[model samples]
Target: MSSSRRVRPLTALALAASAVGTLLVTAPTASAGDYAGACIRSVGSRTSPNGWLIPARNFQAGSSGTCVREIQFDIAATIGLDPADAPGFIDGAFGPKTDRYVREFQSRSHLEPDGIVGPRTWEALISRTTD
Candidate 1:
């Protein structure tokens, strides 16, 4: 997917508003469990336009950036991509290294690998139900 299509956590509030009718957004709580549960519910149940589950691992306040980073790590790890051998920082910034990780993930997943976290890519990331 193109970079324009990627949903940056910085813009989550806006992006989420776009999902008004079809998607459900739970009240933001301090608990990670709340976020995790909500994420699983939101991403697992719905299929994006690209037929993939939009990623739910990101969108937390302080951890939004970290959420994306964790996603890059988890997805790449799950798919056996290169750099899967490496550990991610779990910081929320899309730095050069994170960009590389994302590209690698995209390639492994057979997506465009543009390093953008769009609905299509997110769909692929959340394909499996979260525990």
Candidate 2:
């Protein structure tokens, strides 16, 4: 198995048009992250020509940053749950509400119901699967 995702850039217009059939994004067949509940990854921030890149840090109730924000966005997209309902979610700050949602997502996706976003949790979110 390879931890490589594929991506085809769509024009901004195309992306703005609709996401139904305009994007070509795929997940890695192998794990791209081994975060392991640690928040060590706090630097590398750039758009990937490849599809999604998993974060190397674990986001918990106190994490806050662009990476956390990205994961927050994906949480709603993957679980099809509205972020507004979770209060402080989707705002880059992993508060108690985000923790709750993360745990709920973990349980729903058959991952450990630990309120931490580790590699597996990142996979579930960035893989864009409800799981």
- Candidate with the greatest lDDT versus the true structure: 2
Residue 110 displacement (Å), model 1:
1.4
Residue-wise lDDT of candidate 1 within 1-131, one digit each (tens)? 66577668869877667777435465443333343344556555445776654544333223344345546445544554444535544444566666666677668779887777666666665553244
Worst 10 residues of 1 by lDDT: 57-66
TM-score of each: 0.46, 0.55
User: To one decimal, what is the Cα RMSD in angstroms of model 2 from the true structure?
Assistant: 14.1
State in Å the error of residue 29, model 2: 29
- lDDT string for model 2 (44-96, tens) is 43222344455555778888876666666667666656636755556678887
> What Cα-based lDDT does every candidate model obtain?
0.54, 0.64
Every candidate's CA RMSD: 17.1, 14.1
